[model samples]
Target: MSEPILSLEAVETDIAQYHILKGVSLSVPRGQVTMLLGRNGVGKTTTMRTIMGLLRNKAGQIRFDGAEISGELASSRCRAGIGFVPEDMGIFSALTVEENMILAAVSGAPDRARLDWLFTVFPPLKTFWKAPAGTLSGGQKQMLSIARAMIEDRKLYLIDEPTKGLAPAIVSTMVGALRELKRQGASILMVEQNFAVARALGDHCVVMDDGRATWSGAMADLATDHALQERLMGLSMEAG
Candidate 1:
């Protein structure tokens, strides 16, 4: 296996008075997808936020590309090539699709070639290019959100639930786009509740429970072991 592009060791985070992530540790191998899996309210999203530098770690270290980034601001992290597609699909509702894409680029304008390719990858983005983001359907919003993070080439992408609450057809489209990214050798840390999606996309898996990383290994191993799946994620591939 290649060296990890990102690693969190003994990391902890607290939300005001409540301790959230406690001693979480995991690794994302370079150019591979690492799935962050857990039931809801298990601090899965919190762990993603912490890695993206949104929630400051109260203790331990967060290292990106072998460098410690624990004290860096979120913007600095973004500038360092970490793209985040938050769980809420953090697009500005009032902005047009064009505007959202433009804003995602650090230079204030997306590269023309990449923009064209993105439009192909997500045709609806081109169809509704001038439409306000708020007017888009849920699936379109998700496409826009993913496109924004992908507007520029990123070293590592922190994605939270790309398949959540979407129709199966839409989910498949999302899956196809993500698979393309994987082919391009993008390193991704994604939080997914959909086991099928996770199994399909994840190269490595990190199972979290109660703000702690409880397991880390190959996705294939977890996928084939129904007993392990039930113990960690509470479902086997057949049921998931």
Candidate 2:
């Protein structure tokens, strides 16, 4: 395979006295959604934070678009074409939906063609274009968060816990929207806890546990291996 759009090798991070990530390494191939999956507290979110430079890495290398990004500031990373949709969806409650989208807008005027594309992929965003982000439902907020990231024209996107509290129907819409982004040549490294959605959207799967990558393989292989899923996620096929 060609070099990944994003790659982390032996990334380690410490919070206070606690070591959250223990040499975790993974890569997101260009134009694919590489799902990071595991049980809660498995360092999935930490991995995303580390990639975004929110949490400084104590060890290892992080490369974006073929250059080392471990020491880069968060703002520098953003300018270098890395967008994030945090677990909280980080929308400004006081801002209107359009304002929220505009806040993340890059140099060029918001891409009208891209906005139209987003409207087609995420219908709720189109319906709530005029609504305040805070007034919108949880799913709507997630949709807006995603739209903001897409507008950045980033080479890679790190989305954490995208479906945390959204409705089932909305989750389906989000998955479809991500697939559309992938088709448009954006590389996504998403942290997803929902098995069905992950399996459906991910081209590759990486399982993290206690701050380390425990398993990784093609999504197709992961779908067939019940034992692997059970070992990493603490869930069985019968329950899944």
Candidate 3:
């Protein structure tokens, strides 16, 4: 395989007195989704935060496009073309959808073409263009969060649970939008709990256990091996 666009080698992180990431290592190949999966509180979000420079890695290296970014600031990381959509959605609730998106476009005013495409991927953002973000439904808010990150192109996206607590139909829509993002050649490292979502969107997969990446392989392999799924993810994916 070609060299990964982003790679973490023995990356470790700490929060106060807790060691969240204990030598986590993984790679996100260019233009593919690498699902970061684990049961709750296994440091999956920590891994994402560490990569985005929200939390500094105390040891090891984080390389993005062949440059070490371990010690970089979060704003520097953002400037370097890494977009992040945190689990909280990170939108300004009081602001209109348009206002939220405008702020996310760091370089300048939002790109018209990109906004148009995102509107197709998520139509509600356009429907509620002038509506306060807080007035949107849960799914719409999630879409707006993703749309903001995607308002401007980025080398990679770090997304956390784009579909958590949504109806099945909304999850399906989220999956479709993400698939479109993949089609547009976006490299993404995502943390998702919904096994179906992970299985559907992941090309490559990494399983984290107790603050470390314990397994890494094709998502297909993990999906088919029920025993492995049970062992790593602690639950087999039940068909719907």
Candidate 4:
């Protein structure tokens, strides 16, 4: 197995006097998609925020690329090659799709090859290149969000709920795009509510509950163990 590109050891985070994470720990292996799975309000989003330094961990360590970054700023973490796509998608709604892509480019000018590749993955972005991001559909907005993150190369991507509220066709498109990204050696730590998408993309899995890791194993193991799914996520795959 590849070494972890990101690792958290006994991480804890509190939000405005409310404890959101209590001793959360997990490893995102290099070049693999690690799915963070759990029921609602189980600290999955909080964990992602803590990893990106959007929320600071009150205790324990966060290591990225073999260096300790528990005290680093969020901007510093971004410069260190961590890309984040929040649950809200975080696009500038008033901006044109092209403008959003431009801003996401680290050098202020996107590489042509990478841009072309993204256009291939999401054709709607190319079609609506000049349209306001707010004018696009929900799925299109999600595509734009992912495209922005991919505009620049990064060591890892932290994506939250890419398929939420999307149509099945759009979800299929996202699955294809993400699969291609994995094929191109992108390492991703994604929190997805869509079990089908999670099953399709995840190489490893971490189940969180009440702000702590309740289980960790290969995706294949979790997929086959129906009882485990019920125990961790409160629903079996068939019922979910």
- Every model's TM-score: 0.98, 0.95, 0.97, 0.97
Off by over 4 Å in 2: none
State the lDDT at 226 in candidate 3. 94
Residue pairs with backbone overlap in model 1: none
Candidate 1 local lDDT, 1-240, one digit each (tens): 667999999999998999999899999999999999888898989888988888999999999987899999999999999999999999999999999998899756789998988888899999999999999999999999999999999999999999899999999999999999999999999999888999899999999988899999999999999999889877777777
lDDT by residue for model 4 over 135-154, one digit each (tens)?
A: 99999999999999999989
Q: Which one wins on lDDT? A: 4
Candidate 2 accuracy as TM-score: 0.95
User: 65-90 in candidate 2: lDDT tens per residue?
Assistant: 99999999998999899999999898
CA shift of 113, model 1, Å: 1.4
lDDT, candidates in the order shown: 0.93, 0.86, 0.92, 0.93
User: Which residue pairs in model 4 clash with each other?
Assistant: none
Candidate 4, after superposition: displacement of residue 205 in Å? 0.2
Error of 3 at 203 (Å): 0.4
On a 0 to 100 scale, what is the lDDT of residue 212 in model 3? 95
